[model samples]
Target: MPENFAYPVGLRLQGRRVVVLGAGQVAQRRLPALIAAGADILLVSPSATPSVEAMADAGELRWERRRYRSGDFEGAWYALITTDDPEANAAASAEAEARRVWCVRSDDADAASAWTPATGRSEGVTVAVLTGQDPRRSAAVRDAVVEGLRDGSLAAPHRRSRTPGVALVGGGPGDPDLITVRGRRLLAEADVVIADRLGPRDLLDELPPHVEVIDAAKIPYGRFMAQEAINNALIEHARAGKAVVRLKGGDPFVFGRGMEEAQALAEAGIACTVVPGISSSISVPGAAGIPVTHRGVAHEFTVVSGHVAPEDPASLVDWSALARLRGTLVLLMAVEKIGRIAEALMAHGRDAGTPVAVVQEGTTAAQRRVDATLGTVAETVAAEGVRPPAVIVIGDVVAVGA
Candidate 1:
């Protein structure tokens, strides 16, 4: 540890209270980082842009919908001043200091007691780049450096985990381009990659030949490997001091069974991290030129798994409420149950003529799409031979271009 390093450990702001005085792009860029850090945010903006407003509506943030005031810093552990008004930022900075809370000024670094650093994390490894001039620039440089170091040895070795460390990453839908920058970097650095068969194979091909590749890929139901065996292999590889990546098709936490793996790792004393990815539940339909939500065609979108266990309570989705949602319904892994799902929706009051589209191999060069109404979608999809790893989108928006 460097002697000059006063705050050595980066602030783990998970569940911490943070207040942002602005609702602009600066705040937007920083919002994702804060949310990922687990911060409970309070955004104060007299006027919020569409994205910010959407986030507030989605419950990702608590919007005050008012001008920033000195009292906004009263109980905040940390505050960010991201407004274009320099004078307002200056006042917020002073208020933050009076409350003994740390604050960062978007335009005035000199007034900041401490500045945020450019940060990147790999299995138990965190690298913070400080340029002493611009943290944003430093962050960009850090991202590039992290990209370059994906396959190289770390500048410093990480503490050896006795139980080993594993990373469960979502490779995103099928587009190699849709994978998060972090997910791509981790893939390059991973010593071993255990990927689902449904995940994009092109991504796995990007790895160096020396990287061990194991095919743990599973299909919905016809035939697949046991989940327990997959978990054991991840543990075994990590305990061997090799970085293991359990890559999945979409956002690991979103119906990807990533939590189950993470829980197992924790019980075994192994360290793990989850990197979010674009899910086919939304991205696939989008690539096929279908908007999940529109001004009036649809106002909400519900993502449900088509792989629910027959005995599972969730298997009985509230189809009546779903039909009344005035939004789009997207089903993942539901191709096999297409007829049943459509029947349920129709029984619950959904219009038989509701437009539906099945997108297969979405986001890939070999993409296939089939458009039909709810009444005939099951038969249409079956005849079209659309397979697993496809998304079913049902709503009027699917007929927008029809």
Candidate 2:
């Protein structure tokens, strides 16, 4: 192969035979893309990495537990030679060439008949970048383009038929960047987005003008709409033949009241899907340099909603049992009632001097951390003017990274 002479093209491998000779790191890296392309993959190797083995166990591809043979590429349209043995790679490449099958060699690019580009997919468009033989340059450029597409900096207008359904998408902690790729893609396809106060607002702003945006926080009933009304809205919009995305903050199951809406959709016979997000309970403390569970420091961690005081009859949490555990405690939605919660914990045998850290608006530009003892956290929170949507971590792990 000469410098910059290889022609770049996308192969439609769907239902086509593709041979992979080797289950090493290189094969592991390339197998996913081949699978995504719907290739009829035949993987040949004596042994494989755990991930590759898992794929085989899951029936994602056919695994032949043996060395590559001379006629392995007999009926293959494409082949990948990733074996570390140069002789083996050469043998596989020779077989592929004899069979008129395009082959990619990981050990030697000059010997390969094809080159796999650094690829990314966004809004049904696959972006593949090739910088001659420079893999590093290709990967860097691919990442930049994908980031632009994800952040709405690069617009690729896709015409999607609006499906009548409700999707509960978790927008992640606070940063728009933290949202999952699937969540973002669903947002792009949504006809109506019912968003809560805590989700990534910047993403909502990026939606097209024709996309109806409903503020779940200000939905007429009061500061927040009644749960029944929210359910009604989801069912109503879906019945109107619109794709409704119920966007919330953090993991939908993590104190987000997502199951209620899911049940409502199920009862109303409307289709619904849930996309999990990075919960603030763990991520917020991590952003503030606090580990909920540290080796030899805290072996366990518990996340609890502290909306109601421990002494309240409606509260289901067992404060006494929580105090007895030698683990880290992460509290959410407890800013208003921190005093009673802290006092209840201490009264139930937890150390008064236990370290506590309150992280406000975590994973965002407005993030702030206030550290105090369990006995003084309430006063510290007040003096610091810490608001809601904060995560409070209690235990020795809070001071491990201090």
Candidate 3:
């Protein structure tokens, strides 16, 4: 085999046949990329990992459930020889070579004619790096390039055909990196982004110049008007044949009022897609080193919106029932009314000395955590100047991780 003679080219594998000689770790690592490229994969193996088996069961690929045979590469445009048996790999490679199909060998790359480069995708661009058989170097370089592309450090404009519709994307706990891949991809292709205050703000700077960025907080008038205007904006832009993204912080359905916006869009006869996000209710506490549910410590975890005090007529949460549960309690948007909420819990039979942790602006650089007890949490929050966009965790699990 030559030292550095591998010609790199992106294969248009969509609707093309590809064969894998194994279903082990190597195949597991390679299958996802092949699947993403829309390749029709034929996997041959006696057994496979649960993940691979799940993919096959889901009809994403064809599984042979047997050992690789010599003529397995008959109609394959590309082949991967990933069997643990060196003889089987060599046999599969030879067959692929005879059939003029490029094959990659995971067991022995030096003996194979083709090599799989470290690859990463950002926006619409796929970056593949090959450092003369050095997988570590290739992966590092690929990661750096992808990071640059994601953080706006690398300026690559992705021009995509905009599908006119509304997508409610959960940006995930205040961190740009925490957003789901689907949400990020939708954001890249968005023509108009109606973003909330809690959404990842740094992502707005990465959007293309032609993309319209609307700050939901500054939507004229007050909070009610802002929400109504956001709903109207989504309908108006999508109706005008532009791809509109309603980017919110945390899970759209978890107190984000995403359902209301979705309903409004549906009522206006607009197509709406909701991309679920990592909710702050759980993620914030986790980021602060507090598990919402711990074995033996907490059997269950309940997430509740504390935007309204328990004493308020508008509040619907059963404070007494929540207090009776021997589990974890995760409260969101409760900083302003923590005193009343804590008081209500204690009065309703919850322990006054229950461990409490408040995580503010979690999963972000400005993130901070303040620890207290049920009796002292409200005063501690006031003294610490904890803000509204914080998560309050009350239960034994708060100390389990500590």
Candidate 4:
């Protein structure tokens, strides 16, 4: 088939059988979309890549675990043939043609009855680009179009109904680029944005002059806007037909009090969209060359809030249980109370000499790492003048990541 002769069309595969002849890279890459389309996929291959096998184990598709045979496409509405063997590919292609099923052949595009396009999505729009057999070109085009759509550079005309609601978006661990595309898009479309002191502070500068940028001023343990005041503000603006965006640092659900805002919206009969951000609990340690979990060294990791001292009645953390576990412990908002927390951990059976790394302002240009142990972390932090918005990693995985 020539490039000019290929006709593009969308296939609805819901409740339909789609046959995949191989489980290699091509199949692994294409299976997710098929599964998401609600296809009853039949993957016929001797083996599969680890990711494809995981999808099968998760019951996303049925794996035959055998070589393709005649009539494999007995009831298939579509076939994706990617076997390395030319003979098998030809046979499957023949079967698909005879069955009148649409087929995409990875080995040879000229011989294939159909071609796969480079696909991408932004919001509710799906962008599919096809430039003959030039997949890289198609992918590049798709990326450009999707990025434009996400950033509102190629804004769609006002054809769809405008939805006014509160969006609780996690700004990701202090990097403007780390914020999700949806989160960025929401910011672009926001009529009003209520921002936090932490998270990605640089993105606020990008908002247009018309967009009201409210400083929530939620400095940890400092003078700040009350939670009720913040909730009332979100409601007041949204009720007046304004598109409100509540932007916070890290994950909105991860100690960001996002759910509280969501619940308030629900009570007021306002819709809310929660966009999850990369939590600093995991990302901060990772950005600081510390793997929260390392194979054999640490199998599990725990993230704890150290905002309050363990000895405080308001604290609910099981310090003894956490100390007993031989795994990585990630502490957020704990810089102020780290001394007491360290003492509690050591007193509750955690090793005094356990490796610890305190990552300050992770993923930003100002990011820095301080290394010590459970026994000396407090003294090291005090001596170094470490501040809030730092992640404290404790356990042997700290050494492994280092």
Off by over 4 Å in 1: 1-163, 218-225, 308-314
lDDT scores in order: 0.82, 0.92, 0.90, 0.91
By summed lDDT, the worst window of 10 consecutive residues in model 1 runs over 151-160
Q: Output the better candidate (2/4) by TM-score.
A: 2
Q: TM-score for candidate 2, please give it.
A: 0.83
Per residue, candidate 2 scores C-alpha lDDT tens digits across 1-402 of 767777778899999999999998999999999998899999999999999999999888999999988888988999999988888998888888788899999999988889999999875678899887899999999998987776555666556664589999999999998999889878887899999999999899888889999998666665545988899889999999998899999989999999999999999999999999999999999999999999999999999999999989999999999999999999999999999999999999999999999999999999999999999999999999999989999999999889
Q: TM-score for each prediction? A: 0.62, 0.83, 0.78, 0.80
Candidate 4 lDDT at 312 equals: 100
User: Total backbone clashes of model 2?
Assistant: 0
Error of 3 at 238 (Å): 3.0
Predicted candidate 3 versus true structure: per-residue lDDT over 1-402, tens digit per residue: 777778889999999999998898988999999998899999999999999999999999999999978789999999988888888888888898899999898878877888999999875678999987789999999999997776546666556565689999999999999998788877887889999999999888888999999998877745557678888888989999998999999999999999999999989999999999999988888888998888789889999989899989999999999999999999988888899999999999999999999999999999999999999998999899988788999999988878
Find the 10 residues in a row with the least total lDDT in model 3. Answer: 151-160
Cα shift from native, residue 279, model 2 (Å): 1.2
Tell me which residue pairs clash in candidate 1.
15-38, 197-217
Q: What is the lDDT of candidate 4?
A: 0.91
lDDT of 2 at 114: 91
